[model samples]
Target: MKVVRSDWSRALLVCGKCSKKLDGGFGPKGRESLAKALRRHLGLEKGRRAAMGVIEVKCLGICPKRAVTVIDADDPHAWRLVDEGADLDAVVETLGLIRR
Candidate 1:
């Protein structure tokens, strides 16, 4: 296996299936996926070199109504259910992410 390096201090996994269902339910125009919105909000570059990683992943299997599921890599035990257009700052805080 090839080893690579990243600047990530932590990782955030957003539910891609849920993001699809909501149809880009985040951001000012409400037309950006949570991952994209967050990345933009934090000024993060895509891929491994970013300060942190926000990856859209498959269904986490704990789908909630009108909400997307998220899991923080550092705290996998706690799953967060975020409603469409929820406050990004709050979400960032909940996920323990620092804004750049």
Candidate 2:
């Protein structure tokens, strides 16, 4: 097995189904998915090279209408539900994605 390394300090699992339902409810023109919005908001790159990884996955099963389900890998016990057009800064702070 080949060993791989990543710069990720935390992992965010955004529900794809929820994002799809909202149909790009985030970003300036309201035309970006939650994952993409967050990445841009935090100035993080895509994939494992980013400081924090934001990856979209299939339905998380706790589907919320007009909202997306997000799981913080560092703290999986609690899942976050972000409403459509929610503030990205607040989400980043809530998820502790900011490296201090």
Candidate 3:
């Protein structure tokens, strides 16, 4: 059996529709996607490495009115709809991806 193993680090799932609807509601001047903002805040690369993985996925089905749906791979049952201009540090910590 071929066993392929890699250091997964951490995982994040961002809603595509929500991100698109907001049109980059994160980052400086609110001109960055949720995934990008999280990535920058966590100092993670574009893939599953460095610090973790920030992946933009299709609509998670919740579709918040004015926020993006975010799901931590470790905990998918409960999703988080992050509002615009929210604190990145708080969000990161809440998601359990980063510490205080």
Which lDDT tens digits does candidate 2 get at residues 1-100?
Answer: 9989999888999998899989889999988999999988888899878888899999999989899999999899999999999988888788877833
Candidate 3 ranges with C-alpha deviation above 4 Å:
1-5
Using TM-score, rank the candidates from best to worst.
1, 2, 3
Q: What TM-score fits each model?
A: 0.95, 0.93, 0.86
lDDT of 3 by residue, 10-30 (tens): 677899889899888988899
Best candidate, TM-score-wise?
1
- As a whole number from 0 to 100, the lDDT of residue 57 in candidate 2 is 99
Best-to-worst order by lDDT is 1, 2, 3
The models' CA-based lDDT, in order, is 0.92, 0.90, 0.82
- Better structure of 2 and 3 per lDDT: 2
- Candidates 1 and 2: which is better by TM-score? 1
Clash count (model 1, backbone only): 0
Pitting candidate 1 against candidate 3, the one with the higher TM-score is 1
Clashing pairs in 3: none
TM-score, candidate 3, is 0.86
Candidate 2, residue 91: CA error in Å? 1.0
